[model samples]
Target: MRTWLRHHQYAFLVALRRLKVQPFSSLSNLLVIALTLAVPVLGASILLAAQPVVREIPTSPEMTVFMKQNSTLEQAQAFSQAVGKEFQAELANVRLVSKEQALKQLQSNPSWTDALGALPSNPLPHAIVLTLHETPDLVTRADSLAKTLQTRDGVDSVLLDSEWVQRLAAILSFIRIGLWILMAGVGVVVIATVFNTVRLQALNQREEIAVARLVGATEAFVRRPFLYMGALTGLLASALACGLALLALTPLNKALSSLAQSYGVQLTLSLPEFSLLLTAAILVAILGALAARWSVTRSTQY
Candidate 1:
């Protein structure tokens, strides 16, 4: 174990020295890798930040049954009671808002004073609002209930208030799928970037590799330093990427914070998330190095 550790330590030392040899070139490679990685990392962070807000939104389906202008509060209440009795299993909460109550609510709101005051009589109809029990069949159930309501006595119209919420959910789902695709593409780009970096380094040192093989150095032994090189490159690039993301977020959040604050949420990356991103970066970088295996091997003496 001690011998193996020493070998690995030597290989890592060599890798670090190789990275330091041309500071400008290495820094440029790191920056390129960092920028490529930043795209998906920032996208993922934004998606995760939006999750809490999405969860806070009330997506439960609702139905509002408006009564005729001539319908009395007693009729609306009786219908509400009937709905509660008949669809108790499908219903979560049911409330009847009488026309007088709605008018009083509008009256309470000072903004409606002039428009409402001009009316000789209250124009609002009694409304029975149904909040359905959440189910996979919620839309189907709401449609069934709506059809039934439209046929009932004194019901002016049944309005279903579920489509927009469902549409919003669908939109978010599409965006999530799109984000995953973006991540996959970014991963490929990461591997390619690292692969090219390792390949170029290997080509530059091909003569040395050939001489090492002549000295009886096995491929694994020769490859260790390069592997460490790729992994370290990836690790450093990812760290830079995270820093870049945070820097980009500072200005972005300054703009989004006021808008997001209006909705009660924060849009910052968490500690665990940084750890996760770093792990991803290192793994991808290592893959890139391993992919450049042929480049580091000398098939014929150079």
Candidate 2:
């Protein structure tokens, strides 16, 4: 076991020496791999940052029924329950936002606090918000519900402010799908880049591989160094890709923080993102190297 380990370690060392032989060429290839890997890393990070924000967005179309300023929480709750029951099938969720609850929620956001502070008392009225399911006739059903609620006793007005929300949600869904497709395509590019690099390197050593085979060296013996080189390249490129992706977070958060703060969210990427990208890079690099095994075998056989 010790002998086997020592020989493999020697092969890895040989692979390291091969890369050092042409430092410029090796670095250029490594940079190519790094750039290829960076695409997915950046895409995944963007998706990760956006996921929480997207989930927090209330996408279900909502019909807000504002009650008279004098309406009590008890009356609002009773009205909410009645409306919820009336459209149980069409409604995904229904909640009563009392004047106090609404004001308290608004105060939690810094952006609203300044404006709210100027008011002598909470200006928010008691309200029932009906969250409707996304269906073919969502606008129709919500519009009909809003019209019905507008005429209800004690209800001051009805606002159907969710059509745009649903449209935004649909657009986001399409963008998410497009991003996933883009990530997958870039991932393929990384693998292909690795495969071609290893293949070219193996071909460069064809004469050495053929000579070793003549000395009774097995295919495994000749292939080990190439495999090690591929793995090392993967590790290096992954590290570079991880670094670039992490570095991007600074500017990304800088822009995102300013925007996110307005929405009461602290958006930032951390070390976990580094670890995730590194792991992915290693796997992709290894896969690409392993994929070149047949090419190495073909070269050695000659």
State which candidate has the highest lDDT.
Answer: 1
The 10 consecutive residues of candidate 1 with the worst lDDT sum are 293-302
Candidate 1 positional error at 300, Å: 8.4
What is candidate 2's lDDT per residue for 1-302, written digit by digit as tens?
99899889998899899889989988987788777767667766666666676678765587788999988888998889988888899889998878988899999999998999999987889988888889888778878888888899999999888666667667767877877787677667666665677778888878877788889988778888888887788788888877876788788778988988998987775434546665776686676577557557655554
Instruction: List, residue by residue over 152-231, the lDDT tens digit for candidate 1.
Output: 88888998886676677777788889878976786676667667767778878888888888899887888888878877
Question: Backbone collision count in every prediction?
Answer: 0, 0
lDDT of 1 at 204: 80
Could you give me the TM-score of model 2 versus the true structure? 0.66
Q: What lDDT score is found at residue 190 in candidate 2?
A: 60
TM-score of each: 0.79, 0.66
